[model samples]
Target: MKKTFVKIGLLLAVFGLLVGCDNSSSEVVPPSSTSEEVVSSSEEEVKLTEQEYQIAVNYIVRSVPLVLERGVKVPTNVERAEAENPLPTPELKYGDNLLLITAGELKYEDEINGVYLYPEYTVTYSFLEQEPYAGFTFEYDDIGRYFAVPEYPRYEAEYDNGGNPIHTVPPAKAARLYVTIHIEERFTTFNMDMILEPQAIIHDYNLADVRSVPTGSVVRVYGYFNGYFSDWNNGVLCDGDVALGLFKLQEFNHMELGKMYAVVGQFTVYNGLPQLQWIKTVSEVEPADHPTVKEPKAVVVSADDFADQLDIGNELSGPLMHKVGTTVVLNFPLRYKAMLDRDGNAVEPGALELGKHADVVLTGKDSDNFEFEVKLSLNYHMGTDNQAAFRDFFVTNADADIYFTGPLGAYNAINLAPFAFEGTLSLTPPVVS
Candidate 1:
């Protein structure tokens, strides 16, 4: 996701404040899977049954789209200093009285005393009661309103401290006085049949159109399955010159190569490459009806042309950025010079220990002498023997001209991870004194 930075200021107002109690001593009862409508009362401190508490949590979870639609609203009484500052305060706007919510590391606030607080706010809520409400908590950042697109909550499988998947109820968003309470009040009349139904609207898009939108957009696209990268734990989809990387693909193991598939997922960017992550569905296309299920051919280009496509200053604007996930046949004339370790440090050819991956330095034959020193994953699908053979062949015959073919990829710079070594040619020896 793209990082959005905003200047936040404290807003003081005269309004009834209903702070919640923090029952840390009370055991946290997990929410239930049943989608029962929770009847809320206007009276403060309304006691709830275990199932009702679970229903309330589910209501909050389902209301994320509605809350985001309402967005953050700043009070009219906020004051700003006129002094020039690096972080300028944004102008207040009239909208729904909603607080921007987030969790994990991106959260800007920390819990102090019994309340989850933001640095910009002077007011804090303390929950001191041992009630069912203690099981539900949320943190908010008003500055998040400045984001071009808000990050919506996604409830997937829960994980343990050790990063292992565990079966449990998905966590709920904290209560905002304006939004959460409003949702709670409506739940009294809300239909229980639509409790588990999805609220967000997804749109269909092609690979080219998907590239133009911001990250975090939920979209569906149709493309030919290029292949899967075992090293990266992701797949690829291609439509002509454009290709999109597929991450968190649940159906990757069962997918066939060169087949058309209708994929629904959230568009995201990892490093500098565009990808669809947290895949929702993958439906295969019938080959007999749709005869265009042929494999995507690589775009053949010289090393100079490939280098020119890179715009290091602006990753999104470059020609190469558009082809980051597509297959490419890089026809370059280079002489392998040295074997490098993971840290890009030069290592002796004999001392080079072949692990799951290795890197080699290949210098271009052109006058500019462009270096293809980016680390390549040599033994992901290929075994250590293949890595050793490539190393020995290139290192022993240092003057051999080489060619490469693989999907275009990037980290901080362009890389050909899990690339194939097509072939090599003997270079003519130059006369020496």
Candidate 2:
């Protein structure tokens, strides 16, 4: 096949490098802000000055680790087996670091086609912690350095059984980068060459993989509700035959009790729990009822861990701040103090008056028997019947152990409460008299 080489440019910034493309027929591409030297080559020989070779080696050694850590896709053919020990290398040395180069090869085709190069032993000293394997590609010209990777396929081609194209000519693979480099003397070059292949499809994540994704990144998650707290517009999605305790917060009406839904949003880690916030899209796909409601893992922690005090306007205070958006079982028991009317006045536990706040005054310390008070806010649309049921439940279960679930979050002032039940506030069943 006929071949050509196109020289591109690279702009190196403090955080990362941005690649540039040049389509002009000129072989001597002007350098941008990044290039310190230039490289030239012909059909038979590829040449780089000693100074240029050293710069390239140093840059690659320092930058490749960052690239891989940024979630750049690893080349398909790179072996991932960590070197139990450092591998052997070639002898020729270059640059102030006396960096050794093992092997280097450059291939060029037509003017419109990009050049390809491979290096065998570039950065042997440092390794990226993110992945088991790492590699980098660069091309230089009179203008600047250029980094390139395999281009992704734009469209999947369809073919007939005979293996010939049924509709149109096959499209060529996309070109990723082009560059030129200036070399002063014969210097050792690294021989690690990464073959550019078509990009692969990425898999969407399940609840099990929530923590593996970087925080604050938009992710797609699908699951069915194990159970939900209608008091708050949040629910738990069950996967892996269990309620992973992955919290999903949505303000749109109510989610069907056992329906499966897919949500695309920013995944946040709040109060040691995985929560989906800033939900962009949520839609019911179908019903998923097989996985029954899974009970929460009841780990005993200090009541202080739940919340020191409920503040209505600012971020949460005390350990509960970190426990936001998570389900926790409090070790210290709180007596149901009183149900406050909407005006924040304390009313009898059985008062029919509807209020926005529920107060829990501490009764005793675990071993020490000390006491403290914590407040809870209830903010949700409970119909007349549901409201009466909630009042009865609180009044009836007043003596039961309280179980709290949902993401700790801020509420608008119109609602008028700093601390509110994120999900459901459970009270243990009172013993029969």
Which portions of model 1 miss their true places by more than 4 Å? 1-201, 287-294, 310-321, 365-373, 419-433
> Least lDDT summed over 10 consecutive residues: which range in candidate 1?
189-198
Say what the RMSD of model 2 is.
19.9
Note each model's CA RMSD in angstroms: 20.8, 19.9
Candidate 2 local lDDT, 184-276, one digit each (tens) = 222222223222233222235766566577765556677664444445455556553333333445464456645677766666655445666
Highest lDDT scorer? 1
Evaluate residue 3 in candidate 1 and report its C-alpha lDDT on the 0 to 100 scale.
18
Residues 69-186, model 1: lDDT tens digits: 2334322111112224322222212212323332111112224533221111111212222222211133344433312121222334333333343534333222112112112222
| Candidate 2, residue 365: how far the Cα is off, in Å | 3.0
